[model samples]
Target: MVSGLLWPIIKKTGPLLMLLGLAAGGYWLNRHYREILTPDIALGERLYQQGVDGGGHALQGVTQNDIAFDDAQFNCAQCHRRSGFGSSEGGNYVLPVTGTILFKPRTFERADLFNKLFKESQGQVFRARMRSAYQRPAYSDESLARAIREGVDPSGRQLSPLMPRYRLNDTDMAALIAYLHQLSIRNDPGVDEQTVYLATVVGPNVDSADKTAMLATMREFVEWLNLETQGNLDHPNFSPGYRSDFAKAFRLWRHEVWELPADPRQWPTELASRYRRQPVFAFIGGMVNGDWTPIHDFCEASRIPCLFPFTDLPPTGHTNRYSMYFNQGLILEAKAMGRFLRAQKDPETRTVVNIHSGEPRSSQPAKTLTQSLHGDKRYLVVDLTFESIEQLRDQWQKLARQQSAPIQAVIWPGTFDKTIAAELPLLARYAERLLLPSPALEANQTRFPADIAGKLYFSYPYELPTAYHPHAFRVRAWMNTRDLAIENQRLQFNTYYALNLLQFGLEHVVDHFSRDYLLEYIENEAENQLNPGTFPRLSLGPGQRFASKGAYIVQLVNNDQRQIHPVGDWIIP
Candidate 1:
């Protein structure tokens, strides 16, 4: 009777008890796994790149002397950079916070001696040799939180006051740390132990001779670089001092030419196929005849750097991060022309006739010039579009018949040749002043007549031919030594400048091999006297994609001597 009574109770309570136990265990496991494996990486990326949090609010921080800052103005990407490889700026070293660097124990070695010296110099390195090496344990999650929140390192040492202490809750902090843990952990796609691969995109519209010149210059530079790198590695004398430390950064450079298809629509597919076959670290010294929007889109999508392509047309109206141009190309020239016209004191120059071949390259600038002169009541802007050279001649004749005042004529011939050169003299007869695009004069400098040259005002983007630039001589000397013909000075010099810039940027990087890091260095060091005199000046800063910022409205002076002079100071509009 007693056993039977106890059996009923046991059966009823035992199953309920087991069920409750299982529920508790499951809950605990879920929480543990969620904390370890399910951080919001997308949220972390937002906070890192845009300085916005999960709630879409700007993140806040405090720097030296408790100066408050928001992510809108100063985000992590601005300093540590998108790749998490920190940069050295104005003697202050921003330490790398990537998982590759943070998750491992930090030990001081002879290779890092220079970095340590600069980092710990406190604005002066008078006795840097006397400083001792530093070591710290790998960061635990809690320590990382403290480091971010309190500006402290894993070794319990205070970080530099320049480093900002961010205000983040546990969840946001966890997400950010998660992102950092995986940032730049693997080597970039195009690099290996011994060689780094690069590519240059040659558009379908580029001339055969221009393409040949660009490719030859790039190949010669690569060959010379590889030879120098090999020599340094093989020589016993290079193994002794700081040179050996930097020798680790040296790698043989191998490059490929990515030629796009004829159709613009197929360019993306062609580029994708090429990239799929083999990825490249960057695109350098590219040349394209038409719009560069397709290549720009491809580069931005793939997170690759497109540096200094030779073109008169670049993508418009979009903010870019990976592509850097020498200038705004045709757009810059057009805006400069508008500003030049508006500043004129002559009241007789009232009507401005903007004529183009209706091609995208010419029409876009024609439209841009109209927009720049939109509200200025001093001048009336008129747009004339033509289909061909024959149509352009007809349109010019029509304008000449209707012309009344001493008007100014701006011609944007999409393509320049002997036919276009022949029309310049006729166009000059109708207008008091004639302005031609840069390419018009560049292609037919020797073909213009003496009478037409006086009225000609070319939208010149580079340094005037009359100006003395010492760097030009140096560039020519280098080309001469290499046995390269000087057929296109602007194209060849710009190519040579691009190669030199790549070499400088790579030297500064010293084996980090992050595309973002390379770009950051280029932006910071672009104006350090590296200009090869193609432009008046070449410089870039944070978020500045164009290196040369201004242009001149130059007048052709002597037709026989082929000399041109700027009418005024360089205009930056």
Candidate 2:
């Protein structure tokens, strides 16, 4: 037929459209199948294997007595083993004083480590270790290089006296680091002085047999306060008693210390609510309302410098968005818990119950008495201890008898002791008891929203943990929601929305460093575990060059020792 020219145009255009459609289909498929690794994810895997905390590697499964250590012999049983504890098969005994350690954890950025080793300290925190290591002539630069290359300590000291140096051939170090170029970093958890112990600090490092006031402060913080020295970030102006007086904590460097009046922030107890909107001062405030007086009273009065000084993330959008410093937000968790439970809830009956009974929440995001629970949906909050078994059974019978849509959900969020959690009957009726856990949850006792001792009651520079909770703080202000959610039996602070208290401490930092190195080592661990004939090369999985799935704390549980094993903390089995 006398065909129209349309066939040519249609033929050309049809192919182009087909190509476009294929491209769209490919993009959708990639999005669906993409597997990204994240920092939080690595945290979920088990590495400690019953040997240590999430932040460290330790002999957890074995009792302290089981790991033989005689102090007079200065034995470190964990690594050196018990053949007289590093006495050695080679017939050479490693001397503790003859060697010192240079811990280059992966978290130790070379620049940062160089500064820490060479600069950064005007104080004496590291005097003993640094001085002792430096004094050894064998520890000269070449020796360090050889030790790293040959697995020896600087004093020609065999590693039993120290961490056995890795035999990183130059080619291996270069290629391995090249492989690690894509490794991701996120925030780290808190740590403290309790990590090293006072003896480790005072041992061979400090030549000063005489103690100074600074040493006294260090001693007290370690022994009593359970404080971890976080270097200089926390200067003199700090929390509690010293928050008001700068001179008490810090020697004023720039100017004369701003001597603040003691009574300046004392709140009038009756008019507490009036001062609620106003800061009596940053550090100072009395028990005006339910919230204890602001801990930053002294620093507030003097306007001492603080961390993260602004309210919102930068307008440039956290451009200074990157922070190596750990804030409570980075550490503490315990939001978004309701959603997880809400999703996994029983649908037929519409009852919501809360079961917390211990320390109540000091701040709440649950809004108000009316808002804590949905109005139309049925609500029933009960405590295991609230009623005798007979009464509770009767109540459960009633709940079970409710109309089809009578109760929506029962939110049982807090941690009851095993005795209670095991005994609670109604929880068995639910799909699953939601536990949004972090390493902190296991360690955080009744005293903390996170770790046991790491509360705002500690830490000088950081403000109250309650104040920093963005979701809770912003929402709670309107409703005077203080103490409401904490009272509600169904909710709790956990990894979902709760922050860990010790994230910023020194032990946390070292633990983080240890973990970071462990991660690099873990690819090796995994390879060894699988013993894959082919070496596993690093690749950004699926579609991208980076993933956030690499962060989780792995616990090794043998004989019920659930210790979090960071990668570098020890030799993995």
The runs of at least 3 residues in candidate 1 whose Cα sits more than 4 Å from the true structure, single-residue gaps closed, are 1-37, 108-122, 125-132, 403-405, 416-418
What overall lDDT goes with each candidate model? Answer: 0.82, 0.27
- By TM-score, how accurate is candidate 1? 0.90
Clashing pairs in 1: none
lDDT string, candidate 1, 1-573, tens digits: 559869989888998989899999999999999777687988888888888887788888898999898756567887888878776666566778878789889854454346435433455533432243566799988899999899888989987787889999888898898888888787677888888888999887678888888888887778878888899878836558777777767788888888887888999999999989988988997988888988999999999988999888888687699999999999999999999988988756378899987677889999999998989887888777888878888888897778676678998888654357788777887888888888887677465877777788888889876667778898889788888887778888899888888887776677778888788878877887778788889999877899998899888676766678889999999
The alpha-carbon lDDT assigned to residue 73 of candidate 1 equals: 51
- lDDT of the structure predicted as candidate 2: 0.27
Q: Least lDDT summed over 10 consecutive residues: which range in candidate 1? A: 123-132
TM-score of each: 0.90, 0.24
lDDT per residue for candidate 2 within 129-181, as digits (tens), equals 43343333434434545653454655565433233333333433333232222
Per-residue lDDT of 133 in model 2: 34
